[model samples]
Target chain A: MDLTFTPDEQAFRDEVRTWLSENAPSEPLPSGDTADGFALHLEWERKLFDARWSVVSWPREYGGREATLMEWLIFEEEYWLAGAPNRVTQNGIFLLAPTVFEFGTAEQQDRILPRMAAAEELWCQGWSEPDAGSDLAAIKSRAERDDDAGGWRIYGQKTWTTRGAFCDKLFGLFRTDPDAERHRGMTYLLVDLDAEGVTVRGVDRLDGDEGFAEVFFDGAFVPDADVLGGVNQGWSVAMSTTGSERGLTLRSPGRFMATAHRLVDLHRRCREEAAPDLRDAVARAWIQAEAYRWYTFATVTRMVDGHQPGAESSLNKIFWSELDVDMHRTALDLLGSGAELDEGAEGATDAGLWMKGYQFALSGPIYAGTNEIQRNIAAERVLGLPRK
Target chain B: MRFAFDDDQIDLRDAVRGLLADTCPPETVRTAWSNSTGRSDAAWGALADMGVVSMALPVDAGGLGLGALDWVLVLEETGRVALPEPVVETAVVGAPLLHALGCDVPAPPASIATLLDSGASLYADTAECLVVLDGDALRMVDPSTARLTAEVSVDRSRRLFAVEMAAGAGTVVATGPQARDAVAAARDRGALAAAAQLIGLAERMLATTVEYVSVRHQFGKPVGAQQALKHKLADVAVAIEFARPLVYRAAWSLDAGDPDSAVHVSMAKSQASDAAELAARHALQCHGAIGYSYECDLHLFMKRAWCLARSWGDARSHRDRVAAAVVDA
Candidate 1:
């Protein structure tokens, strides 16, 4: 039960810290929701790829350092501490790339992983639909074989597609067999956004950012080579993506730790005028963040020891998503009425970063399977409660 | 870095859990509730024979020099059964405190209660020695030297006593900065031990409630099948799972002697207290009428959780410490 980093880990941490200190952006990049902002983020990804800092845990052939899980965690910590921009390629690199590595053919891996790592072809998730959000198995999106054209034709609407508008590609679950059961009929497909009959309409989030969109597929054709894993086995293949989304890849504890430290700094600056309740809230946020950090450490240890995470990922999702919301809420409380001010408004702090973050945090519980669904999973699978 | 117990620690946990499963079940705890001292000599002797009483004492002091992390699982198992023993106070905190203060007293299998400025002490009457904290110094007083007034705790299994120490009584084991550090270490480790116990208690309470809800029928179905009750219990399970890593991390920090160990300890204690409190509320409510009765075993753990939640350091006090470190820097 040791918490101290080994000398090798410390050395790796130093290397990461040095590189981030030198190469990290001096100011926040534009919002990735915007075209210009997307380009800027792509440039940043190129910088990381050039330095082999984009995906440290992946093998070198896939443009990574093949770093250990501990080293990957150290990289994340340094990445957040340096105030680096959020990974613009996370959807491709973290979510889809792992599935590709696991189930993609060698040709697919060779062609897709490097581009995904370099952020040359950005990706978005296509799981939830207008009809199927929490009840993902109810997806009615259909894909029929186009034997002459050599693949399948997809037709459905996928709503709440994060990065849908800007991303060049998507990996989604399409019902391949209309006669099969709910989970059995689905086939995971990789589709080009520029394909004929694919229309993406950006939806304005609460913060007025078009970070996600509603994607409509009208007879979009996809090749058979784009199918991930076996047809009708998409449920298991997609389950891997959901696992990564909730557990390791999508949200790292370092991001929350950095936010926690920022909140502490904000509290320290505002301590003179901060209310007692706000003080307690700030402290609670810090404690929760620290808990999350240690929890992730234990998780990484388990994963490194060859144990795959199970339903506990649901627990992690519920905790960190709620913690993110509460932490931002505390920040707003410390900011008082000024929290409502815009970026350059008089008396605004951190350019209203907390306000933007609070809005985003609210979406966390809704996405990656809603908290209600996660709780049900935790209840039934983790606790062995009887399913109704 | 490994964030798990080694083979030996795992063995110790299994051994203690097995012993408690046989010797100090809820039935034994309920039986001891009516006893004057609320002490079970048989269970204590069995645990002592397992070396838990001297598990944390230094080797030169005729005991294993095991650290808090090694004995944490043992303390957790004690909470699992609501064992009528001061193992946390005596072995987890007291023995280490004495050894740090250079006390050469034999590591007796009997419990040793600790007296802080907080007034109440655990097993004060049953313990052979009472390690009292006086400002920055520690005084190891013979329990017979202090005037003991028994007080009924919410948890009947825990026999609380208010002690009035005699003037110039006991031996001043250490003073000044060294005493201060030792006292601080004791408080942090004590709080951590209490945290682990609370986690274990919450886990047992949740499991017991889940088992009951599965069998107890209402409105033509088992109560566990109801969404409302299921969700409540699910939240309890999540809270317990989340608090676990915090407890383990706190134990690790204490063992590693991290500079921020105090803050980590406070966080662990605060989270564990909240988790246990949540479990107790939902467990009792889910069990309905039977959970409220003294005849039911659920009340034993519920009451134990309530007692331990306020012991070592309450949530409010620990939160203040967290605020000092995090908010105030």
Candidate 2:
């Protein structure tokens, strides 16, 4: 049950730590300074690339260290702990890289994996459509077979696409057969964002940051080789994709650890007298965030043991998503009247990170699949309970 | 890294469960509740003999060297039976903290200790030893040494004591910065274990309600079949399930031994408090007027659930802790 890395893993951690210490940007990597922090984060990714530290888990043939999952977690924890800005290439390196490694052909891997690791391409998730947040199989986006050009023409709208507006490519799901069941006839596609008939429009989130966007395809062309898995097997591919999202990138412990540290620091700076209720709430927040840390550790252990996350990822998803919201809510409660301050407002405590976190946290349960949906998945699939 | 209990730990769980089944049955709890004793020493002794009391103690301390995670397994069983013993207070809360602080108390079997909150610690009650925190310092002292009055608390499952201690002999188990860290760790671990027990108690309470409603007929049908009662019970089930991971993850984190152990433990405790109270309330409501009867065991676990949940850092405190650690800038 020990969370400590094995000695070899520890050494690997030491090596990576030394490298990050040497190369990590001394300045806070640009986030708010840039119109899109995603672009700024790419610079950090390039730093990781130059150091050969990017995508630690991918095979060396495709620019990865082929490190173990534990080492990967160590790298991530240290990356955030070092005050590096969010890794912009996460969607590409963590999600797409792994999926392509597993389900992508040799040719597909050769084409996508290196570019993703090198930050040559930026990727955005295209799973959730307007009608499909929880029930992803209800995705109505279509990808009809274009036998003439040996490719598929995709036509669909994907919302909640984080960084979609600036993404160089789209890894998403589309229904290939209009007459098939919800889960069937879907295909996973990798489409060039600049291709004809494609449009990416920014959407205003509660944080007022254009972090998310809507990617609409009137008739997007995708080579048949761009099919992540087999035609009509998109559901499984999409499941694996979303699963990777939930299980890997979204479940990154560093994000929460940084947030958790920021939370404690916030309380220290913001609280005048440390109201009792706020104190207790802060403690619970730390406890859950800590729980998430270990929960992720446990998940990584399972993966290390050659087992993939299934219903257990549901547990992780629920814990992390809800904790994210609860943490911010507590911060807001602690701040009381002070929470009314808008971003960049004068004398704003924590520089309105709490406000932004509050807004971001609102999406925690909604995105990646709602907490309700995760709970139902756990009850029905994990517990084998009768679906109500 | 493995979450499953090893073979011996599994056997320990099964054995404690068997003892609980044989000795602390629902009927036994009912009788004990009706009596002024609230618990049976004979059953507690059986637990002590089975080494359940010393399950979490270090092996070098003449007890099983099971980790905090292992104790959670026993806690679940203890919760399942709704045993009226001080497993949380003595084993989970008191002894481990004391032992960790180098207190050479006999390794369990009968370590009768109660958790004393800051308010209670200041008021010195009838407890022999009290767990107390003064600012960032935690002191374990014999309350009999200090004269203070015990205040009436909301829950009465275990004796709540108010103890007075002059900031000394607790051997700096942890102090200054480490003091809060140590207290937070113990509090979180205790809360997580207690919450797991509460989950077991909640499950039993909900089950009792379901069984009672199913068999007790009203308006020419079983009360359980009624949507009103069914929905209430369903909600209870959902709360229990929802809180399950918070407890499991908390305990798992503590057992897994992470730095954020304190935070995770609080979530479990906080979530358990909400879930257990809701389940108890709904279970009592579902039982109707009969659930209030002295002959029923529902109130025993219910009273214990409410009592344990509020003690050792209540839901509000835990929630605050979580927020502080999670939402800061």
Candidate 3:
């Protein structure tokens, strides 16, 4: 087995690197004082889409480069390394698009994909009800067929709907047969955000990033064509989409390396009176960052080799989430007494970006399935141990 | 970029597996550990005859000329059998370094090779060439060219040696910063090889534990059915799986002539070392008191894992090197 990129691949890398150097953002764009960062990120996404460099892994039929997995990984690495804005349409590009390509009807694909590619269609996940979190199979949201209406009426409460309040569309799951077994009755559907009887309420997080919300669907009508996969097959469709979210959202090692560089930058810009723990914390952060970089490289290599991500993806998730938390904690440790100050405090650099990152990291393991869940996955699936 | 072995590599790995299984039986390894030679010379010679020792040597040197990945393919088998011989020293270290040094390094025992510093110095009495360095001074000596001494080592599995060089007993193979660089590169390669073996040992240890837990009854149920112990086993499994790819990546990079091989080599080696030690320890814990006994055969893999983990370089040292390179990069 060889891990070295071919000369052609290296040339591709150079081209990507040069393009990013010229086009990527030099500073974070303003997102306004709101939960949705879509306004700023959507602009950045359009620039990438115009360049035809967005969604490298998608097939050529879907406005993608049709690149190899290795190339896709490299593109992401370079993109993040260039300090580009976070992907604003990832829910569409990474999750919904792939599912559509594999399982959605042609009509469905034709309708949603181009708008998604142009960043004109912002999407949000409508998974995880107040009662059903990790136990996703227990979703109680109801969707009933209406022959007269020529569509399904979705009546359910979906909580923890990330960015749902601002999204233009919702890709979610609901139980079509209440009497059926937990995993047997679910159906996946996509609904227009402006659909009647849909109410979105914000849930303010500790981090002050009000990105999550609860959505109550009262007789929300979704066209029959919006059903993803076959009727009872929604469970599997949801599973596939969830799997993509787990496996595809990882930031490449180069990005973490770039983050480490940022840490160095922060360290340098600090005043001489900065706490010494700040330096030590930065050093530790550097170590963890580099470690994750190597870890990511190894994982990417495995993925490029065509190994379907097994429980090992969970392991990567845990490592990265914990590392992110520790790194941000280190930032807080360095800020010392100043951490008590809110964002935009006088003399607070980058509006306390590190502190903001610290608070955001607290929700990482929780949102993308908890670390405990990941451990069980590793134990039960990867290790071939008997489930408890 | 493929991580799985091709057909030929799979065949070679299988052959190596058979050879190690036959030659380094637990009984045989323990016997050799207490023997005067502290190694199975017959087994070593047999391996050399079978091309294990000669696999990585250049085809022009009457050898197979296989690459670093091939060596990793075979080393995994070596760990499975807990072979007491220094195939790594003779095959990976001695042959390639000498090939690079442009010197015709002899076969082992006579070659007097130990890894950069994996195990205690073995066969000091008969070592014809001694490789050591201070700063940039690389001293290679024939026995008659240097004064030598021997020392008692705690690991009875291998003989230990000490030597004091005469004023001009050594000839510098390569000197100055370049030589240091070459040695550093060679040491990283050596560490990668050891890491591959550690992965093999960890795999075997986990396999053995799983098999035993499935059948061995405790409190009227199969031990594997227990959640507490299963979780521990799962932890070891995760560690092993995580380490394998890193080790494979390093070896593949080295084999493919990648410039970043050194950094990868250090990372893989450090992770593998930690995984192997954890796996071995957990295996013993799972095996209960019988695991402590020499008769159980688990100790064979455990001892090998323990030795290999600390050999070449320990985790902390490799981590420091990795840190320097990454920071500097």
- Compose the digit string of candidate 3's lDDT tens values, residues A1-388: 5455788678878989998899888887644225446677777788888877877766666677778777776787788778777776777887788788889888888888877887888888888998899888878999999989888999989988777776789999999888898889889889887889888887866767667788999999998888999887889898777676666554455656666677666656653656755655565456556556545555566676666666667777666676678776765655667766666678676677777777767777786677667766766676666553
Model 2 ranges with Cα > 4 A deviation = A9-22, A26-38, A273-276, A332-352, A383-385, B1-5, B40-49, B53-70, B86-196, B202-275, B278-298, B312-329
TM for candidate 3 is 0.88
User: Which one wins on TM-score?
Assistant: 1
Best by DockQ: 1
DockQ of 1: 0.74
Candidate 2 structure quality by residue, lDDT tens digits, A1-388: 5544578878987897788788877866435323656666777778788778877878787778988777777788887777766666777876777678779899998888888888888888888889888788888889888899999998879998887777899889888889988778888889899999899998867667778889889987899989997888887876776687666665577777777676677777767766766766666666556556655666666676788777656656766777788888878887888887866789777667678768877887787777676666654455343332
Interface RMSD measured for model 1:
1.2
Ranking by TM-score: 1, 3, 2
What is the lDDT for B117 in model 2? Answer: 40
lDDT per residue (tens digit) for residues B1-329 in model 2: 34334677678788888888888887776665445445655677898777777777788887787777677778988988878666776777677777777777576634444444445531134235666666566666565665455455433434444544554744344557666665656666667777888888888887777677767887777776565665466557656655775676666667767777787777788878888999999989989888988667777788888877886778887776666566443
Question: Any residue pairs clashing in model 3, and if so which?
Answer: none
lDDT of 3 at A236: 89
- RMSD of candidates 1 onward, in order: 1.5, 6.6, 3.8
Candidate 3 chain A, run of 10 with poorest lDDT? A29-38
Listed models, DockQ each: 0.74, 0.20, 0.30
| lDDT scores in order | 0.87, 0.72, 0.73
Assess every candidate by TM-score.
Answer: 0.97, 0.77, 0.88
> Model 1, B1-329: lDDT tens per residue?
77878899999899989988999877789888998779775788988887888888877776777877887787888888888888888787888787777676576545788886258888888788898878766788889989999888888877888899877789899888988888878888789888989998999999999899988988888888887887798789778877888888877777787888888889999999999999999999999999988788998899889988988888888999999877887
